[model samples]
Target chain A: MTDKQRENLKNRIAVVAAWGVALIFFFPIFWMVLTSFKTEGQAIAVPPLLVFEPTLENYIEIQERTNYVKFAWNSVITSFGGTAVALLIAIPSAYAMAFNPTHRTKDILMWMLSTKMLPAVGVLMPIYFLAQKAGLFDTKLVLVIIYAMVNLPIVMLILFNYFREIPKEILEASRMDGTSTYNEIRQIVMPLAWGGIASTALLSIILCWNEAFWSIVLTTTEASTLTAFVASFQAPEGLFWAKVSAVSTLACAPIVIFGWLAQKQLVQGLTFGAVK
Target chain B: MNRTLVRLLQAPSIILLLLWMIVPLSMTLYFSTIRYNLLYPEREGFIGLENYRFFWTDAAFFPALMNTLVLVGSVLIITVVLGLAISVLIDRPFRGRGIVRVMLISPFFIMPTVSALVWKNMMMDPTTGLFAAMWNAMGWQPIEWLQDMPLFSIILMVSWQWTPFAILIFMTSLQSQDQEQKEAATLDGAGFWSQFYNLTLPHMARPISIVILIQMIFHLSIFAEIFVTTSGGPGVQSTNLTYLIYIQSQQAFDVGVASAGGVFAIILANIVAIFLIRAVGKTLTV
Candidate 1:
């Protein structure tokens, strides 16, 4: 066979292999969704009958057992609230670092990124103490603050990259036209970099939505996010696979749908400044 | 008013981040040096270096450290190698490429808690999980995954969630590969493997390092998966450093020991960060 035929055959094999791997990766999620509709017996069946009669009994039972709407509402409030607060802080910080970068700018950026590596357990005691002392424990405000701090680094990093992509010439031109720094940023910079900022916000919201460690530790029943809600499914009477799957499905649905809708933008934002 | 107002606008964020870092860290440092235990809430006082000494002497310390290294190292290697292969395969145009890409990347976005629970219940559960069902269908006994090999199970769950991230980075990097280099290599009779090794690998080095560094930082603090699935169980066999700290603080109520462990974790992470920054700086121009 010629080289061209060999290349074509190789490409075909590669594509087939890639598809197989993708399916394997996606199969667990498919199984979880499938199990959510199965009866308790069917969910834990020995042979795991693939052709079982699907039912919504698990969903109904989960709803009856737990306040699904309350948990969902808490998730929405905390995730969006955290994202808003983070953006409010990160925008100015990123703006300062991007446009008026001083000698300490890189260090500041690195410091913020390093904060992410600090294990939540490290500060669990102090934060927990502070929360209790201040009566902020299990409150939405506490979650909002913690989530903002947790996701601040990624937000700042992404926005800094976005702002850097907006040429310095544009900002300089706006300044030449007598636009104030605030006006230049609001009118010229933000409008030009709106796509990047929006995507960064979306990514931050997703991160905050998915954050489990602090949500589980810092909150109980009051302001628990979806992660805490799902974790509460762990009961003393052994594991409830069917009901847990139902809860898990509900918990992950919003972010998964958001991901599906904004996949292109999400991908772009995650890979921001990664390649170049 | 201009300079004062500018500083005023920035003060809240700067102060917040400063306090956020300093307060917890200083508390951890103070707690590390003292003989503090939450269970005996009133028995707190300075015992300089005692807590650190205890942590160093503890048998679980080295094992926890090694487990952390093993977890991070194994996941980084597995994800990068698999990710590169998958990314390269999907780099070329193919039918249903977009769907395949989405399917692969979707796992990364799944909440870590849900991912862990799904793996534990549906895929890794010995009796009724998919693996067990498959084994039963083949007339074989089911292998207990988390029960028998807890660390491996945790590693598997984490790798499943994070490999997608590596693939995303690799795919983005692959898109920027120079077609001219490949054409020239082909003209010079370079085979596919040779071209990939010589040209593609060199181009992908920076992204590979970035993925490894980022994964190391995150994976070192892996908590939710271990917490949700096993709770560092089967006698702390799967207990990485973070889990060990959690057990120390929450279960044992030994704040000093936990804080000491936290300091150790901080130092370890900083070491990794320093190496990563130096390595990436050597390769990355901007």
Candidate 2:
């Protein structure tokens, strides 16, 4: 083959390989989506059908049997609620630490991170008992608070990294202009760091949305999120593969789309800026 | 400029985190040393390390510890190795790269419970699952995944969900790499493997460590997958320490023993945490 033809061949091979790898990585999700459209019998059939008449029966049955919308709504409210509170608590402190660093700042940040490292189960019983005693068990409010606390260290660290990137001269110039710290933040820092703040919120929201452990432990039915709702299908006797797949697809769809959009921020935020 | 104002701005977060950390943890520590079974509240009293002794002596404790380590270790190795290969493969631009990236990263967004259930019933079920179907198509008996190799099964599901994370981080780090060095190495007649070893691997050290540490923290407490799929069962074969503690407190209603197990988990986590904090701390300062 000529050199030009060999180059073309190599590019084609790369394209094919990339597609093959992507497809394999994506196969389980595709299978779940496909299974969601299959009839119950086809869903669990030996030599599962790749070419079957698609049906909406599973979706319809799931809707009739359980309040899928309710669980989804709870997920939305708690995740957003948690992200908002986390940002509110995290931003100011992050700003202070980033711009007005003290000798103890690093220690304090490390301490906060250590708190996150404390395994959740270590505190599970007390939190559970306390929630019951306070009559706050299985409430969205409690979940929101716990989620915020759970995500606070991450939010603060990411926001701190973002705020640190804002050129110091901008803040210094404002200070020389006799602008107050509050005005400095409101007028300049917030606007400049807006993208980072937004990304922090998005990342935390996704984390909260997919958080399973605390949600399953803390909420039984009244305030169950999509994670807990999906776990409810763990009943071993049921042959409701299609219905479960439908619920699984529904539970993961919105966040997966959101995750794709926020992939860049997710990398930066999740690694605590270690990668970037 | 008053430093008090800066301290004030930071105090709310500090105080809240302090309370959140101190209250429950101290309570857990307190409970660990005493007898506090929910089923026998009247029998509650200071037991002085007896709960810890009971937890340590249990046959499942050592297995659970081993399982936790194996699960974390296997997943770490799988994700890092695969992530490195895939990141390098896609590092050079290819057709439809954006869509390919999305496809690759989709699994990380899946809820653990959903992923577990999907793997258990739809994919791994030997009777009529996808793997079974594939095996039967090829005229082979399907491997019973959860029944025979429960821990490995859980490891596989968790690894699938997290490999995307490692890929994302490694891919991002690769974008910021020094291309001149790679070009120079190529000019020096170094092959792809040599270039990767001398140029890419060293450059990716920080990200690789970050991925391993972060994934370790999450994997150490893996619960929902076990809860949904194996229930850490077939006689504690798949039981990690986290699941064991869940069984102790939630099922057996022995809060004291569970708390003791929790303390053990705390220590295990701290051993990892100290190293992570130091590594990350160095990065932050620099």
Candidate 3:
């Protein structure tokens, strides 16, 4: 056999092995989605049924029983709402930092990041007490505000990096034409940096959606996101297998789809350009 | 834009972050020094270091601390090692590799509570679980994972979620590697193992540390998984610092001691954060 045959054979082996690893890594999720389609009894079958009559009974049952829509709506609202708020606050902040650098700019950026380092557990009590006092506890607005704050630093950083990528000449030229700051942002910055902002928003939304620590601890039923909703399954029973799987599937599907779409850009957003 | 206008644009974020950082944190410090309870809000007074001492001396403190260390340490090792191996396996061009990468990274996007519950109910449940069925198929008894090894169970769940993160980071780093050198090495009779040890490992050094540090900051405070799967117990076996603090604040309703626990957590996290921030700081430009 020639060397080409040997190399092609090796590549085939690698692809097969890679597929095996991928399947193993992905099995639990595949199992969860599969179980979501199973009836409760089928979900917990003695041998864990691989081939069964698929059903939407579990999904229907979850919605009827727990109003899964409410929790999912809350998740949707908070994730999108939080991203909107973070972007509103971060866009200008990042815009300034990107265009108008000073000696303190890096220090200011570092200081903002240091805020992220403050452990959430450390700050949970005060926030909890304060929220209760302010009558904001377990409200979607509170979740939105808190999520915005928690993700503000990274969102700003990602935007800052993206904003910096827009050539300084365009903004300066706009300034010379007497375009106001607001218009400059709305016209020059937003249009030019649309891709970055979208990805940053995607990144922020994903973070807010999967934020278990705050969502789990800070909220109960009225404001509970899907993370909190699923935590209700903590002490679940065998009967809950299909329901929990259904809820879990619904909870993660949107973000996972969004993540796969944003998969390429998220690396730079997540690492804050550090990995490159 | 004038500097003043620029400052105005920047003010909201800086101020928001400032208040976010300082307000609750200072309150936590104050709460730690005082005697306070949620149930007895009317009776509060400065107790100096008593709350700290009480929190430190709690029966579960040492075990929770050890559990925190073990959980973080073991998860890091598992994710990093497995992540390296998996990334290398999938590194060479393969058919449908994009889909493979997407599948592998899907777990990272799953919320912790969901992942934990799925693992607990469908994957780890002794009799009705997938693992049990597999165990039975092989003629063995299924271990009660969350019951018998709660900490390990939590570690496994977290590693499953985070290994994708490590893989993603490593894969991006691997893309930039000098393939010409690899080909040169290959022609020089260098085997895959030697190439990996010398080329890939050295190339991945920076990203590996970034993975470890970032994962450390995250794993140190893992809560939802333990909360959902084990509730930090079958005993206090799976309880970590964050859960211990959660119990103190939410369950035990001991605000003073919980604040102290929070302070301990803050201190512990900052020790890691100082290093991580320095690493992240390098990327910032004025």
Candidate 4:
């Protein structure tokens, strides 16, 4: 082959390889979605039916039996509520650190990030007991508070990074015009950094929505989020693969879409601005 | 603006974090030193270091620790290496690249319990699982993945979920890489391997470290995968420290001992966290 043809061949091979890897990585999720539409026998068939008559029976049955909406609503409440509360607290704090950082600001930021390193299990007992005593066990309020606290550092850090990018001269300009601090934030900072704020909120909501460790540990029925709801299928006789897949699909669908949208902020939020 | 006012604005997060850190942690410490089993409430008393001794001496402790180390180490190696290769593959534009990126990252967004369940039921179930069917098609006996090789199975599930995270980071970082530098090196007669080794790797050092550090923090307390699939069973073979502590508190109802285990987990996480803070802290100042 000529050199030009050889380059063409290499490009074709790379494209094929990329597609193959993506398909393979995505196969399990595809299989789960596919399985959710299959009949029970089809779901467990020896060859595992990739081609079958899709059904909504599993979805209906799951909703009827487990009250899927309740769990989903619980997830919605906790995640959104948590994001709102976290933003409420994180915004101003991040504003202060970003615009008027002191010598100890970096230390304070790092210290907050370090709080995330404290394993949930370390404080699991106390939180559980405290919640129980306060009549807050298995309640949406408690989960919301905990989730907010858990994600507060990340929310703060992302907002701080975003706020820091706003030119100080703008804030200075607003200040020189006799704009109050609240108005400066409300008008100048908020408008300037809304994209970052939205992305931070999006990322926090995703984390809260998908958080499994605390969701499973801290709640059972009343405030059981989708993570806990899906986990409830872990029992031996609960091996109805079709129904489980349906529930899992529902639990995963919203966040997966949102996650794709917010993928840009994911690295920064996850790494605590360590990378970018 | 006064420094006091800045401090006032920052107080909520700082104070909340301080209370969140100090209160439960101190309670855990207090519980660790006392005999505070909920099952035997009568046995509550000061037992300095006794819970620690028992926890250290438990038969499951060492295996769980080893499993934790192996799981974290193996997943890190697999995800980072594979993620780099995949990122490099898709770094250059191609047909359907956006869809490919979306498909690859979907796994990372799946809730852990859901992914674990999907893997356990549909992918790894030896008899009815896809792996089994593939094995049988190849004229080989199917392996009981979670039954025979539980820890490895857990490692595979976690790596699958996290590889996309590595890809996302590396791919994002790759976009920032200097194409001009690569071209200059190529003009200097540097082969692709040498260019990658001498230039690409050096540029990616910080991102690679970030991936490692962040993955370490998340992987150390991995709970749901184990909880859903194996429950740290088949004779504690797959139990990690987190699972072990879970069993201690939730199953055995030994608060003191579990608190001791919690303390150990804190210490281990802190070791990694200190390194992480130093690495990331450098970037913060810049």
| Best-matching candidate per lDDT | 4
* Docking model 2 quality class: medium
Q: What is the DockQ of each candidate?
A: 0.55, 0.75, 0.82, 0.79
Strongest candidate by TM-score: 4
lDDT of 4 at A102: 79
Q: Please, what are the lDDT tens digits per residue for candidate 4 over residues A1-276?
A: 996797789889888999999999999999999999998889999987777789999999988987799999999999999999999999989998998887889888989989988999888788888999999999999999998999998898889889888999988888999998889889999999999999999999999998998889888888999999998888878489999999999999999999999888888888888766
* lDDT score for residue B265 of model 4: 95
Instruction: Give me the TM-scores of chain B across the candidates.
Output: 0.93, 0.98, 0.97, 0.98
lDDT of 3 at B30: 97
Q: Judge candidate 2 against the unseen true structure and give its global Cα lDDT, from 0 to 1.
A: 0.91
lDDT per residue, candidate 2, B108-175, as tens digits? 99999999999999889989888888888889989999999999999999989999998889989999
lDDT per residue as tens, model 4, B201-249: 9999999998998899999999999999999978998999999998999
Residue-wise C-alpha lDDT for candidate 3, range A228-265, written one tens digit per residue: 88887776544578778888888899999999999767
TM-score of the candidate numbered 2?
Answer: 0.97
Q: What ordering of candidates by DockQ runs from best to worst?
A: 3, 4, 2, 1
The RMSD of every model to the true structure, in order and in angstroms, is: 2.3, 1.6, 1.5, 1.2
- Lowest summed lDDT across 10 adjacent residues in model 2 chain B is found at B277-286
Fnat per model, in the order given? 0.53, 0.79, 0.86, 0.77
Which residue pairs in candidate 3 collide? none
What 10-residue stretch in candidate 1 chain A is worst by lDDT? A267-276
List the candidate 4 regions with Cα displacement exceeding 4 Å: none
Question: TM-score for model 3?
Answer: 0.97
Query: How would you encode candidate 3's per-residue C-alpha lDDT over B1-286 as one tens digit per residue?
Result: 7889999999999999999988999999999999999899898899999999999999999999999999999999999999998888788865698999999889999998988888888889898988898899899989999888988888889999999998888888899999999999999989889999999999998888878888888888888998888888978999999999999999989999999999999999989888877888887666
Model 3, C-alpha of A93: deviation from truth (Å):
0.9
For each model, chain A TM-score?
A: 0.90, 0.93, 0.95, 0.97
